[model samples]
Target: MSINQIQDEIIDEFSLFSDWMEKYEYIIDLGKHLPLIDEQYKDEEHLIKGCQSRVWLHAGLEGDKVVFTADSDAVITKGIIALLVRVLSNQPAEEVAQSELYFIDKIGLKEHLSPTRSNGLVSMVKQMKLYGLALHAKS
Candidate 1:
């Protein structure tokens, strides 16, 4: 589906909930929908260092867009990574580079995360954006 469609869906899901717990449960459900990453991709190169949980993200350019596959050993962390991928992945390199993570604030994610987890989430976003910028430069 298109990014707008994904955003609409997320908005719809969250809008239905009046409680933070329900909203988080929906986000976790969305994460469960993400396909599992390949075991081989869990190596050091793919690993996102400095995160409390083992989060791995692999990105590639498909035509003009950046595609990503990610996983985390912890369930809630995996959900967080899935949410990040949803907001950032599958866009043209230039678009990915320019995109602000509007959803992060809209979803109140930072308040929900511990300081370290929040920092790790920022690290993940920076890495993804860097990969997109590098691809834009190469192209």
Candidate 2:
């Protein structure tokens, strides 16, 4: 699916929960299911710099699309990355780079996070877009 379609699906899913606690649980569950990143990519080069927790993200081009894989030391952070990966991974490089990730605000995810976590989230998006831009240039 396209990025916006995926974001809409996530918004729908988050809307099912009645409260923030349930939303938190759901986010944790999403984290649990995030596909494991390759051990080789867990090095300092892949680690996201702005996150309070350790998060490693790697992206590669497959055809014209960028495939993202990631891992984080913190559960909430992991889930947050998983949500981003679901929306941005396996998409065309330019599209991924330019996409507007409105789901962050649409689901109130940004407002709900701690200040540090919020910064981490922005950093995550930035890194992902950087990857897209780099890979797009290569192709």
Per-model C-alpha lDDT, please?
0.73, 0.84
What TM-scores do the predictions have?
Answer: 0.83, 0.91
Error of 1 at 30 (Å): 2.9
Q: List the residue pairs that clash in candidate 1.
A: none
User: For residues 1-139, could you state the per-residue lDDT of candidate 1 as single tens digits?
Assistant: 6555665666666677889898778767766777757788989988876546667888888998888788877666778788777866888888777666655566666653445554355667778888889989977
RMSD of each: 2.5, 1.9
lDDT of 2 by residue, 1-139 (tens): 9999999999998889899999889889878886659999999988876546777888989999999999887788788888889999999999998999899888888753445554366677888899899899998
Clashing pairs in 2: none
Candidate 2 structure lDDT = 0.84
Which residue ranges in model 1 land beyond 4 Å of their true spot? 1-9, 112-115
- Residue 98, model 1: lDDT of 66
TM-score of 2: 0.91
